[model samples]
Target chain A: MAEQAFVTGKIETPVGTVPQVATGVSWRDRWGAFRVRLGFGRMRYTVEPGLYGVGAPRQDSPVLVTANYKLSFDHLRTALAGHDAWILVLDTSGINVWCAAGKGTFGTAPLSVQVAASRLAQLVGHRRLVVPQLGAPGIAAHAVKRQCGFSVVFGPVQARHLPEFLGRGMQATPAMRRKTFSLSERAVLVPVELVIACKWALPLAVVLSGISGLFGPAAFWENVREHGGWTMAGLGSGIVAGTVLTPLLLPVLPGRAFSLKGAVAGLMAGLAFLAVLLSRPGGAGNDFAVWAWLLLIPAIASFFGMEFTGASTYTSLSGVRKEMRIAVPLQVAATLCGMLLLFCARRLP
Target chain B: MRRRQLYLRGVATLRLEQDGCMGCGMCLAVCPQEVFVMAHGKARISEQDACMECGACMMNCPAGVIWVQSGVGCAQAVFHAMLGRGSEACCAIEEKPGGGSCC
Candidate 1:
């Protein structure tokens, strides 16, 4: 009995996967044929910014630094489908390079040690390690050079531009250095934040609707159904705008601060709410409701949008601090005032 | 690009000890300041002032060797906390169990 024990069954959890190579030809030119692809299969390894050989290449290939997130790693590898490169992954706790760099995981000292431990010095003859532009917040090129005898060369923000960057002898033009937050970029964010927000909103809605029943079926129930629905819709749309649309249209949207851009988007959403309200037949008689909306819609949208600043690249710590000092109280006051007016109107009637 | 260091006043007086660092590289991975570096096979605080004192490194460190007594400067988080949700619930609002209003 002690010698043999039977294990009947086990369940395998599905971790995100990535493909080793991409299929379908993308861009074909004199140099080579590029392919576009997607996969969840990323090499399972802790990022330590050391030299890594890809596709059985020897150690002397061009060293490229990236974040540990599987997606980030896949994108980096995908863009270099036909090239040989030494990928140095920084330990970012499975976060993307840009966010991790912003949080400080992809910085100088760890990078140096990883390089040493990975025996990067012996692999390549040249001391130049190419790092992404966004990783600048955490990495000091000068420090890495002094410590590891490797001069850090800053690369383009987009992995797709790697060929062009390397072709030009590591010179990054304005377009390469500048990061773009496009529609595709913004759309990807919607699922996560919306999923997170809805988890809370659903339960609260159930409770609010429940409590309103105690005041009498006709008035309180009606109020909950109508007003509660409006609030949920508005809150949901605001979250979508800030986390999705705002970042996607970041350049086209107004103002340098992400909050301001989010505010502008929220204002657009507010106008849409007002339009819907005005379109109703009893719109004029419900002046108090209209007023409540006028105060609250933009405020809710603005607050939601402002919350996204933490996740964006455009906002600075000091700038966010200053914005919060001014923006928060105004949002709270507006929301409270709107709630109070609506409550008063119902109570009196 | 000229790397810009956003000047922070309070962090200068704060003491950040990396002496007992296990070289697990978690701090080097999470710090936004490019502050930590490995010297003599151990992690050390290289750039002191660049730290925003985000305390993410402190929170995520497995060994609890990293310590930074810092607070979030985000107004939204502060507002949530002022509304009675603890400040710890601030920056990580999305990470909350049932993500919703701070209440």
Candidate 2:
């Protein structure tokens, strides 16, 4: 594909790639971010990997580096809305810097390759590249300087602090480098978790409703109307507890294992389920629905909790393994017990 | 100032090969958590209590002294494992789940 030519609102660099970018997020960017939260067209959310002009940057401007993932790119540019900096975006294959760094795609090879390909040396007078702190995993600073003759300086952990970081002579306070998974960040992840779980869950509910026909139409529909609602609620709350609540409340949840914490959250959600069911008299046989949710909700929540550990800033692979050894079987046992209760509930007089 | 503790106890998913450590400050510089401190210029684990185990130090260490079984910690992988399939839960692993709808 031909490299895009210089446009009216773009900064032209010597590299021949005239990357166009505006200061704040466009409506498309906003909509795209919102769409991603809902798990719609997530993989497709990528910009072309190359250099972009944040403002009218000069040759002496400090060059900031980032991943080609559109969301990551947008965050960087948007944060620097009023600044003039040369943004050199590497092709991380649409993955964010933090994740792509872990996967090894956003490493030295690509950084060097993009630097050379973009003719960055000729474009800028300095030999320093400002990289995001999270991309430190994939990058070897000394090696980049050795290979490309450009020293790498990792910026603050959050791009929001970019202005302060730059204003303070590019030095980060300890707080700036600190990685925080705030409540809002944790909550933002819930929509996608809910979307993915519901993909199979809603369908399973429909199929299970049909399967309930073996118990006769009246019983089947009764099961469909009563048990199905609880099942959906169980699944929804489980996703919330595991992915959102667990991470947000990770520090407070008892036990070291993520699954354990999730189970606690699930148990709470299960109690809530019971309270709702008790209020409605005909909501499935009281004993069966209560027993099933009590078992199932926590189990489902446990799985989500352990899963959230993968996304957490506190989990280890070894820790996760240890957790799995103990937690999985228990989660399975609880889930199966719930299923067994449901199985028995289906057949009762 | 003390930060809020968010991790569980005695479960730091990290290993430091003391023999190979060049006492380089890479781990100290790269770690987001205050997991390491330089003692006599040697990288030592002062508080591995809440290490996110992102493996930035492991990846950046010139001496290859740091080790972390790094991968995404999503529960979906556990779900896959239960189904007798690879826990393709994280993007860092051999395969990514759902065509890369990572959270």
Q: Score residue A116 of candidate 1 by CA lDDT.
A: 82
Candidate 2 per-residue lDDT over residues B1-103, each given as its tens digit? 6555556567666888777788868777777887888887688888877676677888778898788866655555444556766444445333343454444
Minimal lDDT window, size 10, model 2 chain A = A1-10
Candidate with the greatest TM-score versus the true structure: 2
Off by over 4 Å in 2: A1-8, A216-219, A282-286, B17-24, B77-89, B92-98
Reported per model, the fraction of native interface contacts reproduced equals 0.08, 0.53
TM-score for the A chain of candidate 1: 0.76
Question: Model 1: DockQ against the native?
Answer: 0.08
> Which one wins on lDDT?
2
Q: Write the per-residue lDDT of candidate 2 for residues A1-349, one digit (tens) a residue.
A: 3432222275556756556567666576788889887877666566778777877788888899998777888788878878889888887767788878876778988899999988889998989999998998789887898889999888988888999999999888888877876777777877776676677567766665565554523666675765566666666776666766776787788987888998998888888877876787666564875788788888888887776665566566556767788888898898888877876776774
Please give the clash total of every predicted structure, in order.
13, 4
> For model 1 chain A, where is the 10-residue window of minimal lDDT?
A30-39
lDDT of 1 at A237: 55
What are the Cα lDDT values of the candidates? 0.57, 0.75
Candidate 1 Cα outliers beyond 4 Å, as residue runs: A1-51, A207-223, A237-264, A281-285, B1-103
Over B1-103, each residue of candidate 1 has an lDDT whose tens digit, in order, gives: 5343333333332344656667776456545455677788677877665555555456545566776655443444555666886543242313333332211
